[model samples]
Target: MTKDGVDTSGSGQQSGKPALHSVYSVNNILHKVQILDGVKVTYSSWVKLFILYAKGYKVSYHIDGTKPPAGTDPAYAKLCEIDAHVLQWIYGSISDDLLIRILETDSTTYEAWCRLENQFLNNKEARAVALEHEFTYLSLSKYESLDDYCQKLKDITTQLNDIGSTVNDQRLVLQLVRRLPVDYDTVGAYM
Candidate 1:
């Protein structure tokens, strides 16, 4: 062990060079992470965040749908083992209903990931409808500030874009102008 209590043995070091040590173990960190609820509409940002988390652990291959090549190399075998463990971790991070749906068609982690993505991320029509409804029903209350209202509008627009739908800037601006309360008439007139 080094001064920092990092084990340097078998770290492939030579010439008395300092051995590298991982500051955090991926499994340790991910074990505490919660799974995405299957019943709810999973957002793109949530999915992206999960992918980023998996990338931190160097297990993003499972999501990218890549398969290990058939080989006798021990390194490949070790990677396969790691992939399997990561796959299990991913499995543990999903709801039982969703798990069963994916398991019916996929035997590999990559496939399972793809299946989930397809099931959740590909429903552009439903997402677009929901975003449209949100946009249509959005109203600035008497208690809400103009800045806050505008931010909410922008957020909805962004969500629309993320789900393969878009509201043009002119339309958004027009909506903002139309939705302004009578108290903001002077500001509206100035625009």
Candidate 2:
């Protein structure tokens, strides 16, 4: 797998190694990850696999320091095994916030963001922050219950900020939380 620009054959083979030099743009990263032979990846497929891996799927590193997560949901496990190429494409450079935005969106918005992300990518504008802002606002506003909101956000290891809609007048998320407490376990985070 590629790291800071140099290729490292396997994880433990070299204690410290360089891969891709620096992190490429998200679209660039996607393009490189997409061509893995035998892996028919839609934007959603990448997102789903990314999520599963982020959530710590069991897998072994291959000779190239890349391998599919083992015993993934049967459906995805097959995809990962068939296409180890995607796993080789790592995102050591993307920010935690950008990753969180991708994780938080519903599947539909996730797809839309993929398209939008590519547009910026093609333009040579690494606008992950702008894209994430739009995505977070849309995701947070669509919730009917805190549980649903929390479910979408639970895997977000990165914290988000100031994501409320422009139409929203509240100055703090805790205020909004106190006003609508359908699920304390979920709402308590913001409070």
Candidate 3:
């Protein structure tokens, strides 16, 4: 038996080799990735983290749209089994609202992945405009702490850059200074 108490003695297969089912752990993934709530985390960042987990588990083919083996192929059953586990991971790591929006009947992991990507990324120009507006409206006076305000600004800029809007360092610095509270007049002047 391996760590999870599943027998891995390679019955009728290979000696001392763990079966595909025994190789992956569900808890390990959900712990590392925060639930993708769309507001708390950007879709691109969530996808990057999920890609890292899938790749590390050697199951990225399940979500990378790789064609599964034919039904008669020897490895077909194993692919189906592992893909089921991947589907579980996807379901477990999303918000209930998001789950309700994207859930489909009898979907393969690849289809689910595509659905999520399309939902979040299909309207890139619109998202960028909204994000730009958000960045413009962030005010240091609204946040009690200067650090919180700066971090929020940084996160929005990063999200904008990731979506290809390209917030240059000069503009970012200008925004940073422009949004400062009146109390930071000396500091803003130095910037």
Candidate 4:
């Protein structure tokens, strides 16, 4: 041990462990997380996954704009470095088209996050209308299996709810029952 009792390990960390606020690299984000293709992603799901991802790196504050270090703070530079990594993750996790739309030179991570949220959530009325129509017309026969159809319905309902169009359980059940094929009429009657 050194004279002051600090670990003298060659690893450069106090106890050969990363500091609590270490600048994390973007490479650590998992590959299974889908790229945010505006059309394909149901925004809320992507946001949840991305938040969990950033939190894993102890950088969730960048996503939510909380507890940011001021310029005078000792950790400010480190936060900026980590924010750059967070920004890279955001830029890399989106489609080329979405990247083109949302990219801004010298933009902070919080700015990009808010812009992305606005992109998905701004046109609530239009999205809600379209989703409502889709939910009304969806049929089990259109999908390869009943599971796919139900999942689609659930996704539609979730998107609608995200946009402030609340779809209650009863309404969802009604839609599910109403769209059954003619062959399931007997079963539908029982439902």
Q: Give all TM-scores, in the order shown.
A: 0.59, 0.23, 0.84, 0.81
Off by over 4 Å in 4: 1-32, 38-40
Candidate 1 global Cα RMSD: 6.2
Candidate 3 regions exceeding 4 Å error are 1-23
lDDT of 4 by residue, 13-57 (tens): 564454544444345544735887744577787889998877776
Judging by TM-score, tell me the better candidate of 1 and 2.
Answer: 1
Candidate 3 lDDT over 1-191, as tens digits, reads 56655566644234446454543656555696879887677677789999988888788898888889899999898788888888888888889988987899999999999998787777889989999999998998788798888888888887787678989988988998998879899999999
lDDT (CA) for every model shown? Answer: 0.68, 0.37, 0.82, 0.81
Clashing pairs in 3: none
Model 1, range 57-170, lDDT digits (tens) per residue? 666776785767767765686666666666676677777777777775326677777787776668889978987887877778832577888887887787787677878998
Give the higher-lDDT candidate: 1 or 4: 4
Candidate 4: residue 151 lDDT (0-100): 86
Rank ordering of all candidates by TM-score, starting from the highest = 3, 4, 1, 2
**Residue 66 error for model 1, in Å?**
2.1
Instruction: Name the lDDT value of residue 91 in candidate 3.
Output: 84
Every model: Cα RMSD to truth:
6.2, 16.2, 4.6, 4.0
| Model 2 misplaced regions, further than 4 Å | 1-127, 139-141, 155-190
- Residue pairs that clash (backbone atoms under 3 angstroms), model 1: none
Q: lDDT tens string, model 2, 1-191? A: 45554435543233354333122223344433343111133333444455554334223122223433455565465444423432234322234444444433223222433532443234322333553443345344578865555444432211122122122224334334543545464645655
lDDT for 141 in candidate 4 is: 84
Q: Give the TM-score of candidate 4.
A: 0.81
Candidate 1 runs further than 4 Å off: 1-24, 27-42, 53-56, 71-77, 88-107, 142-152, 189-191
